[model samples]
Target: MAMAVPAQTIAGYDRFPWDAILLQTNSALMNNTDPNVWASQIISTLRSTAVTLPSVDLAHRLVSHLFWNHHSPIAWKLLDIAASLNLLPPLLLVALLSTRIVPMRKVYPQAYRLYLELVKQYVLMLQFRNNSPNYEMIMESIDNVLQLSQVYSHKVCEPGVALVEFVFSILWQLLEAILDDEGLLDHVPENKPRWLSRSHDMDIAEHDCINEMKTEQKEGMQRKNTMIAIEIIVQLLQNKMTSRLLCLVHRNMPSYWGSFNHQMQLIASKSSILKNLKHITADTLLSLMENIHGVVSCNTKSKLESNVVIPAGSQIAFGGQCEGSSWSSIWLPIDLILEDALDGGHVAALSAIEIITGMNV
Candidate 1:
């Protein structure tokens, strides 16, 4: 808020050209001249990527402009220029900024360069290895914040207003970093392993907060690199980057799985994604029930070969054993009364009678 807006200008990295375009775009929006058209062209420019291109800088710039617009009115004008020139931001970058945790070395070397150069303080690299769906739910929360009435009532968060997407992206970063590296934020003990730390995440109440909240922005890459962390998290999940996240979450918070259990119930209730995932829910529930039952009853491991993600289109088998045609449960031993009880104590005569009749009831 302290920095005054500057004259519109163009800025570009070695690969992507965007700083100049953003200035033009913001000028159009602020001046109320063809804002919608400029917005449309910006999105179009991004979508029509020349797949032949070597780097993602232009794409980065176009999207970056969205966040830079409010602080730098000139950047907004530059975004319009990028749109007019058919330049695009990176899709992967947008996705990274969405909800998953990503490492800087893997996702954004350019940004990482800036982080290392401008930030003399050493930064730790940590991965919160729990790949649990709670992170996915966290993403859903972020999406909701973007669509809040005060922010946007549209069905989905759209591009045009860079600030809106930029803000939402920041929320995701806060969640990822807090979940992965809370120590950096001064909220958790720096000596503790990063995965053990956590911070308050974005919520419904915050979504409804006033515009002044924008004035309360945090310092440096914290704002810009928020989505990058999340996008990596998503990439890991999609690519099944399982272990790191698992170790981070489960090892630190064993009970975190308990929270995942609740997600099954929550998702099943009219959430379309959950509605279609009933089988996974059932299998997860079955496994938990079986695991707990075994530990309680036998006082040890289940020894049962049940897996978490069930094989496709298979039901939970009530009867054990792999009999192809027919299977039966072995009857339990029981003592019968009547004459047999008396005969056991007594009777050589009864034994002889049963031997002759071939009946041992």
Candidate 2:
């Protein structure tokens, strides 16, 4: 029945006492106050304060407490607010990635968008070429990405997933070469086609390596991280491009909505991207498909770890049953190709036939 005290009102007399604010917030949480009330209060306080915001370390600690204590929406929102003000700490963004505070559900688009905002800022700040300041954070992100891939293999739309298979593929080859050199494959991932294994054993054989070798290894990792970052940007660019095309088409030809997909398919078939792929080997194509399959297919052998932690005195009970869909029997591409063939698109049909026959080889 009591109204929540505004954080700005609380701080109006005082010069932004973060410790007191934290204590009050904890008390409010313990007393079972609505998360939104406290979140609004915090955001208002941060935005309207005349004094300096909390230091990077202090802000990270505050956000971590906020995240661990109650609902994640508040935590995610606070991070976004901090990021907009350019007050977000690198570690806080890293924590966001590790915790995945924003659930990867289509319904929670705003929360996920805020999550990406923080991630993009952190990524832009990273200079992957040199000895980066946020090396630990970078490595932590990579580890979390691998962990997430194993847990949510069927959820390809999860952030950083596009790079998962490619990164692992390279790591697998690197490990393989090292093992071959050392004459032992003693501790490897459980499955064959090692890149798709339930987990990877990344411990390299110790060697009396020169300083240059160590430097080279570090540079290699930096390059790998750079590639992953670039891929994330590329995916964003592709999405933007599709939206732009859709807008242009919708604006110019309102009646084209009926056959939009058909037109798009035709355009793609004749696109220079496909036509210029004259040197793509069957093995390369098969590997690319296999990588995609590995990403989107659920591996029964892998266990999904629970990241949910219930704080003390929190009576909140979490439970849910997900109705998993059955895997489709047909590949949609094959059906589309068949339709193209039947529709008398001779050139496109011939291209499809060549690709399929090459796959059979």
Q: Which numbered prediction scores highest in TM-score against the true structure?
A: 2
- lDDT per residue for candidate 2 within 21-132, as digits (tens), equals 5765675546644444655565455554433332343355555566433434444444444443334344335443323322221222233334344444443222121123
Question: What is the Å distance of residue 258 in model 2 from its true position?
Answer: 45
lDDT of 1: 0.30
Identify the runs in model 2 with alpha carbons over 4 angstroms from their true place.
1-18, 23-54, 90-92, 95-117, 124-361
Q: Name the TM-score of candidate 2.
A: 0.27
The residue-level lDDT of candidate 1 at 157 comes to 29
lDDT by residue for model 1 (1-361), tens: 0111222322443332243345556666576554456656544433333322212344454444443223233333333233223332222233322322223222222233232221111111111111322322322333443333233223432121222233323323333343443223332223442222222221113212223233333222343333333333233222211222222222222343334333323322323332244234434433432343222122111222333232222111122331222222421111110112222232122211112221110
